[model samples]
Target: MNKIFAKQFNKRALAFGWGMVMAMIIFMSTAWFAFTTTNQKISAEITSLSILEDYYKEQDRLIAYSETSSKLALSQSFYQLAKDSAIDITNSCKVINNVMVWNNNCHPNADFVKQKFLEYYDTNFNSFMLEYPNKMDITYTNVLENTTLISRASPVTFSSEKQGTFAKYNFTYNFEPSIKINLTEQGISLEDFESIYNKILECNKKIECFQKINLENWDISTESQGSWFLFKLKTKKPFIFYENDIENYAPIELNFIIEL
Candidate 1:
């Protein structure tokens, strides 16, 4: 009886020790990820938003390319780009949100969208086309920003497989996503950025244009809370005189996703 009791005690002690070690490891990892994650996210958002300019140019090119070709061919190109982009952004958001929640919301940027955002993607979004390996499909402008979606579409099929009668597709393309804001570079805290991100869904629900966020005939109300703003764009055609109309001035027509 004495020996059995001692063995049981020893086992308990060992398990407890391992549990403590694992706890420490997790704490350490969370701490390290928290360190300057804000700065890292800031850098990531900047790089992503900056890429939208190139995307707009690409959109123009796509439009022009479609005019010369059949709509079916044009649509294939668009679907390829959209599918590739959406999956990429969804993946990036998932990873970022994971890191953020794990790190206690260090710095919620444009990428760190709604809490249910990733959950929605997991339920609704599918990988573009998994025929090509991820490597041949992506190019990284910022290596540090290479969290997966950070790598732009390379669109190359390296290898493919064929079964007895059927061949499985194996290419990767994440439908891209990036939102553009024409507002001036104002001094907003990390919390403010987080607040606007959270409220975007709330405000966007009523406005289809803002929901798609085409940034047309719209102006963001700079009032109250100082942390959040009401972004409004006229939906009707009968020209109502607003202070800052979408047509009065144009900064840049940027394309971005609202997670849906």
Candidate 2:
């Protein structure tokens, strides 16, 4: 009886030990699963935050560019020249093809204006172009319909002590922008998208000739913010009026605003 009782007790002990081990294993597995799930959630959140931060930075940059471009347009001496009919043309052509060259806005290029200036003016276009190569492509065309000249009256003073004078100048043409959006590409991040968008807006604002901007409709389902994405932007710039002939005659100036 004693031996039987001892053997029964041993069996019970063994079963209990097995049960405990199983319980431990189940607990450990549950803990591990919970840890893994939490980790993944944290990682995803981090990624999203990073993307948002990048997007903000890109937007800031674009705004800065816009402001700078606007200010440059306003302060340019060419604005003065455009207002004055006597200085509107370089070689008697209705269009001023090379204001960038004279204003040192662009680099020298193999264009008719450069050739003509070098041949007739006996000046090296390369020097001006070298200093301002990027500025050369800036050009303007007729801004108004059936109007040969536009005038702007700006306050001017010959000397600090002298009374200020108002000068009237005529501009025959203005620079307009033509924007087009290309949607041939694939996925892009939110940051990049915002960057491109802001740039388009800024350019439109700075270029007085831009009349409208057209964009393809965005699909809400696929347009979510992500890295390595693509979109489209398009704009049309039409000369509406001479800068000088703007309804408000005041100092030509540009205002720049940056939002982060």
Candidate 3:
């Protein structure tokens, strides 16, 4: 009986040791799996943050480019309006003592030009801004005898895809645009000066020219000598008004200086 009891105790001890070894192996495996999962989660979070940063950088660049382009567009629009107003005001002028006088019975002055410019802008250009949904502030200033127009466009925003859902990442741009319009006129070569001169002489020299001569395209000045007069005619230079092309246009001064 004593021998049997000792053998049973030895078997019980061996089985307990094996069970402990198995438990240790399971615990080690569980710990290793948990560590690996935690590492993967950390790596994924880091990669996502990196991607988000890159996306924001790209958005910043895009917004900057857009702002530049918007300024250019606004400047171009202002230039067009100024050119149109100048041409219209200049075209409607009459020549008195070799000087051009506008329809408002005034010579070339900044205040008058500014008044007409504002009138033209209010009448014509407001339609263009209606296409954009954002509010824009446009104002005119004359500081130190300089004609300028300022345009302020509201901030424009762009959102990212799924990545921006939680972080709320977005890009926005605001543009401050202003243009100086000098009330200056450039001289251009007259293509039909000879024809115009001939026509003026033909009309003036005619006897009983009771009919009003069609000098619609020209502004006229006269020098009188004892009931006989010589006609001095000038042509209104045409402006090629285009929105995108600012430089391509006819000059505004001394298109024709012909006397008959």
What is the full ranking by TM-score, best candidate first? 3, 2, 1
Off by over 4 Å in 3: 86-260
Q: Model 3: which ten-residue window has the lowest total lDDT?
A: 183-192
Compose the digit string of candidate 2's lDDT tens values, residues 35-110. Answer: 8777766665565566556545544543344333322332232223223211224444322222111221221222
Note the Cα lDDT for every prediction shown: 0.34, 0.32, 0.44
Local accuracy of candidate 3 as per-residue lDDT tens digits, 129-201: 4443444344323221333333333433333433332243333333333333332222221112334434545
Q: Which pairs of residues collide in model 3?
A: none
After TM-score superposition, the amount by which residue 109's alpha carbon in candidate 3 deviates from its true location, in angstroms, is 17
Q: Could you report the Cα RMSD, in angstroms, for every candidate shown?
A: 28.9, 27.4, 12.1
Query: Per-prediction TM-score, please?
Result: 0.18, 0.32, 0.39
Better of 2 and 3 by TM-score: 3
Top of the candidates by lDDT: 3
Least lDDT summed over 10 consecutive residues: which range in candidate 1?
181-190
**What lDDT is obtained when candidate 2 is compared to the true structure?**
0.32
Candidate 1 regions with alpha-carbon error over 4 angstroms: 43-260
How do all the candidates rank in terms of lDDT, highest first? Answer: 3, 1, 2
